[model samples]
Target: MKLQNSYLADFLSLLFPQLCPACGNDLVAHEKIICTDCLYNLPQTNFHLHADNIVARQFWGKINLETAYALYYFTKGGKVQNLMHHFKYNGMQQIGNLLGNIAGSQLNKNEKFAGVDYIIPVPLHKSRLKERGYNQSACFAHGLAEKLPAVVEENNLVRTKATQTQTHRSRFARFENMQEVFVVNNPERLKDKHVLLVDDIVTTGSTLEACAIPLLNIPGLKLSIATIAYAE
Candidate 1:
C-alpha cells in the first residue's frame, strides 16, 4: 500500500508539478513551498543576533522595542520578493508557515527573544481581512509559536480603521495615515507580558510604529518586533 501510494503521488506530481515560488524550480519530495537551494540562498538578515540592527534602529526614538528582526532582506525583483508575491497575493499561505518556522528556529537560539509570552500579528481591519481571507502575519506567528514558548494571540491588537495603501507614501505621511488606526481590545491580557509583534514586511516602519504605540502603553509590557522580510 505504501509503495502504491508513493507511485500514485509521483504520477500526480508529473502532471501537476509543485514549483518553488522563489526559483520556479520543481520542489523535491521533502521540500515544501520553496526549494532547498532557494531557501539556503535567501538573503537572511540575521538581525536577531544583533541589538542595533536596521529594523530595530528604525524604532529607536519613535517607539520602544526590546529587539527587532526579520527573516530575509527584500530587494526589488528578487527571489524573496517573488516568494512574497506568491505568499500575499497567490493564496500560498503555507509559505508564511515555512518562513516563520525557519525564523523561529533562529530566534529560539537568541537570548533577546527568550521568554516571549505572547506572539501577536499586526491585525488587519475586518474589510481587508474579509478580502484577503487570512492575515498573512498570523500564519507566520502560528508557525513561530510552534518552535517557541509563546502563545499566538490573535484579535487582541486590532486594526480599528482601514487606511489607504502605504505603497508610495512618504515616511511621515505613512505614519500620519496609520495614526489612531489600531487599538488593544484586551489590554489586561498583554499587561506585564513580553509581547512579540509580527508583520509580513517592514518598509517605512510606520505601520509597525503605530501598532507598537498602543501595545507599549500596556502596563509593564515589554515589546519586540519580528517580520518575514525587511525592505529598504
Candidate 2:
C-alpha cells in the first residue's frame, strides 16, 4: 500500500509539478517549499556552536545576551536572500517553518540553547501584522518550538508602535528609531526563565536590541536570540 501511494504521488507530481520557492525550478516529490539543492547550499553561520561568534559579539557592549545564533548567511542576490524574499514578501510563510525546523534541529544538538524555557518572536506592529496576515518571526518561532522542547509565546512581548523599514538605515539610525518600541507584558511569568527570542532575519541587530530591552526587565531572565538568517 505504501509503495502504491508513493507511485501515485510521483505520478501526480509529474502531471503537476510544484515550483521550488528559492530557485523557481520543478520540485520533486520530496521537496516542499525549497529544493534539496538550495537547502544544502544555504550558507550557514553555525553560531550556536561557538560562544564568541560574531552574532554574540554584536551585543557585547550594547546588550547582555546569553548567546545568539543565525542559521544562514544572507547576501545580496544570493540564494539565501532569494529564499528570504519569498518567505517574507511572497507569502511563502511555510518556508519559514521549514527552515526553522531545520535550524532548530541543529540548535537542539548544541548545548548552549538547551536551557531555553520559552520562545519569543520579535513582535510586529498590529498594523503590519494585519497587512501581512501573519508575523513572520512568530511563524519561525512556532516552527522552532516544534523541534525544540521550549514553548512558543507570542503575546508576552508587544510592539507598541509601527516604525519605518530599517532596510536603508544605518546601524545608529536603526537603533535610535527602534528604541523603546517594545514592551513586555505579564513580567511575572517570565522571571528567572531562559528565553529564546526569535526573528526572521538580523541585519543591524537594532530590532533585536529593542525587543530585548523590555525582556531584560524581567528578574532573573536569561536571554538568547535566534534568527533564520544573518545579513553580513
Candidate 3:
C-alpha cells in the first residue's frame, strides 16, 4: 500500500506540478512552497546573532527592546520581495509560516530569544483584516510558536484606527499617522511577561514604534521583536 501510494502521488504531481513561489521552479517531492535552491539562496540577515544589528538599532531611543531580528533582508525586485508579495498579497500565507519556522529555528540557537513567554503579532484593523481575510503576522507567529516555547497571543493588542498606507510617507509623518492607532485590550495578560512582538516587515520602523508604545507601557513587560524581512 505504501508503494502504491507513492506511485499515485508521483503521478498526480506530474499532472499538476507545484511551483515554488520564489523561483517559479517545479517543487520536488521533498519540497513545499519554496524550492530548496530558493530557500538556500534567501538573503538571511542573521541579526539574532548580533546585538547591534540594524533592525535593533532602529528602535534605539525611540523604544526599548530586549532584541530585534529579521529573517531576511528585502531589496526591491529581489527574491525576498517576490516571496513577500506572494506571502502578503497572493494568499500564500503558508510562506509566512515556513519563514517563521525557519526564523524560529535560528533564534532558538540564540540565548537572547530564550524564555519568550508570549508571541504577539502586530494586529491589523478590522477593515484591513476583513479585506485580507487573515493577518500575515499572526500566521508567522503561530509558526514560530511551534518551534519556540511560547504561546501565540491574539486580540490582546489590537488596532483601534485604520490609517492610510505608509507608502511614500516621511518617517515623522508615518509616526504621526500611527499615533493612537493601537490599544491593549487586556494589559494584565501581558504585564510582567516577556512578549515577542512580530510583524511581516520593517522599513522606517514607525508602525512598529507606534505598536510598541502601548505594549511598553504595560508594567514589567519586556518586549522583543521579530519579523520576516527588513527593508532599508
**Clashes in candidate 2: how many?**
0
lDDT per residue as tens, model 3, 1-232: 9999989989999999998888788899878899999889999998988999999999999999999999999999988899989998999999989988999999888777877999999999999999999999999999899889899999999999989999999999999999999999999999899999999999999999998999999999999999999999
Model 1: residues with Cα > 4 Å off, grouped in runs: none
Q: Which 10-residue window of candidate 2 scores lowest in summed lDDT?
A: 21-30
lDDT of 2 by residue, 92-208 (tens): 889889888998998899886878999999999999999989999988998899999999999989999999999789999999999889999889999999999999888889999
Ranking by lDDT: 1, 3, 2
Model 1 reaches what TM-score against the true structure?
Answer: 0.98
Query: Residue-wise lDDT of candidate 1 within 1-232, one digit each (tens)?
Result: 9999989988888999999999899987878788989988999998988898999999888888889999999999999999999999999999999888999999999987977999999999999989999999999999999889999999899998989999999999999999999999899999899999999999999999999999989999999999999999
Note each model's CA RMSD in angstroms.
0.9, 1.6, 1.1
> What RMSD value applies to candidate 1?
0.9
TM-score of each: 0.98, 0.94, 0.96
Number of colliding residue pairs in each model = 0, 0, 0
Can you rank all candidates by TM-score, best first?
1, 3, 2
After best superposition, candidate 2 residue 54: deviation in angstroms? 1.2
